[model samples]
Target: MSAPFLRGVEALAQFTAREGAGAAPARGHIERLLVDGEEHEHRLGIWYANTKQRRDKLNPAQRTALADLGVTWA
Candidate 1:
């Protein structure tokens, strides 16, 4: 991934860690990252799917965020 793409993912992770998972700001940041990183759809999709598989470990907000992004175990 490019620096900016990695930075966006890092920012999202940091925001979730600091603000608690699923915060609206964090979700919104993730949405922006998705849009900005559209060129990396395959990688993002893989990440999303992996996250979805770990949904049980995620907070409600985090799960919802992934869902909103179309991540699904099915």
Candidate 2:
């Protein structure tokens, strides 16, 4: 997977961790992550929407990751 892909997944995981189960982020939601000692922000809600729309293009691992985060559409 690409770095951006992993980062987006990581962002969602962090969002899920903080928001708890059965929570869906708002469309403008953003999540921040620290990688290699640097901080990055991900537009998590936008990413989730886009990912759900493009679900057919996602590989098995990607789908599984999202599903593990309790994403119903995944």
Please identify model 1 stretches exceeding 4 Å from their true place. 1-42, 69-74
Clashing pairs in 1: none
After superposition, which runs of candidate 2 have C-alpha atoms over 4 Å from their true positions? Answer: none
lDDT of 2 by residue, 1-74 (tens): 77777888899888889989658888899888898899988898898888888999999898888899898888
Candidate 1 per-residue C-alpha lDDT over 1-74 given as tens digits, one digit per residue, 9 for 90 to 100:
34543543454455456666554342223433334557322233344445555657766655554444333431
Model 2 per-residue lDDT at 71:
88
Clashes of each: 0, 0
